[model samples]
Target: MTKLQAEVRSNSVAKGKDAMVTEDELDNLAYLKAVVKETLRLHMPAPLLVPHLSMADCDIEGYTIPSGTRTIINAWALARDPSYWENAEEFMPERFMDGGSAAAIDYKGSDFLLLPFGTGRRICPGITFAISTIEIMLANLVYLFNWELPVELAEKGIDMTESFGVTVHRAEKLLLVPIVPQD
Candidate 1:
């Protein structure tokens, strides 16, 4: 979050402005978009996406899939697959930025590698709503405040363990303090 804070701060200064980030400004924040993409890649809200039922018998990868078969797309594994991603397990947001192999792909389901919001005819209807909400909220959070890990957490580092369920969430509650920005 410190890195994201710095990015937003730098963007604010580079634009020669110090005010709440507007929707138009958010649209042009390339790095912010990359950050959000990396986040979705790492932590897909729905790991197995909506279960898809095969309407007719078909062959995929030499495997015969019968009609009415229930198929679950493991989006989480797809995003983190070593074949598709470099430093797969690391949280380097730049992988989705310029000069990166996966930079062109997005979560719109068209790119099979990253499908946070499923794709195709059955894609999530709230995609635009979800992405915009997240970007605006995050941009404001990182831009308007200085966040710091609690003293003990700062010393010990944060635990990234996740608890799997209908949707993934941190196993342990993240305890961080958000300080009002001095600037």
Candidate 2:
């Protein structure tokens, strides 16, 4: 949280303390972007990407997949695959930073390991808008105030469980107390 606050506060000096994060400044907020990527990696909006149909008979590994077979891509599993990610289950935003191991991987679909927004010709059309919205909202939140974890969670810890549906949701509600940061 301090890292995010520092990143936002450092960039917001010229914009004024009251000014919300702007779209133009998103490019310079590297850590903010990494946080968003890490968030998506841990809790994806959709666990399974849109299903695909095989165009022709093909063999993957040892199994033969016939044409017209409906195949679902488990994007959540791919993002959390240990072989492709170090400490795969851990929430480490730095993994997507400039020199991090997964730096080259992204949700834009170019990288298969981290395809939170799906990939190929059928990739999400709202991807650009979605990422920008996430970046701006997250940047502003960290820039505007300080957040405190609930007292109950401090002792019990946060519940990372999820309830599956059209979109994934936290099984337990997280109540964060936002304290306006002082000058």
Candidate 3:
């Protein structure tokens, strides 16, 4: 969580916002939201969405999907689709904000373009809890501290590499330097 906060702060600064993040500022931080969305997209904790069994035969995208077919949604692939994102291979959060109204798109099941937490009935049961926790924690941390990459690692840019499992995690552990805010 601390690492994530650091990354968010770094991103905010890169976009020319001051290093500090406040509660009121959260609503206007479209770039931060975009960063979060891009992070979730590129590193989906669950690379494969929950499995489901089709009740009846169905054809989707011209494929003959038979009844009782067990299927899994490849959320990882969907998130990286070039049709939905430009420079899909790059970790560019600005793409989400380049268009009008970055916040117009919904992260819920409504938007097919981005589904880090899956979609429809099988969507993550903990969606609300996860989102609320992240927002509150990020707000408080940014409100309280200024962060930097550790001296030893500062020369090396953030390693965005991933190691996949039940949940995705950084290939290498994240180490950061934190400074408490002065009143």
* lDDT-sorted candidate list, best first: 2, 1, 3
Off by over 4 Å in 3: 1-28, 97-103, 181-183
Off by over 4 Å in 2: 14-17
Question: Residue 78 of candidate 1: its Cα lDDT?
Answer: 91
Across 43-112, the per-residue lDDT of candidate 2 in tens digits comes to 9989897789999999999999999999999989998999988999998999999899888887678888
TM-score of each: 0.91, 0.92, 0.75
Residue 17, model 2, lDDT:
54
Candidate with more favorable, higher lDDT: 2 or 3: 2
Residue range 49-111, candidate 3, lDDT tens digits: 778899899988999999999998787887788887677778776667757433455578687
How big is the positional error of residue 5 in model 3, measured in Å on the Cα after superposition? 10
Candidate 2 to native Cα RMSD, angstroms: 1.6
Reference-based lDDT, each prediction: 0.83, 0.88, 0.69
Candidate closer to the true structure by lDDT (higher is better), 1 or 3:
1
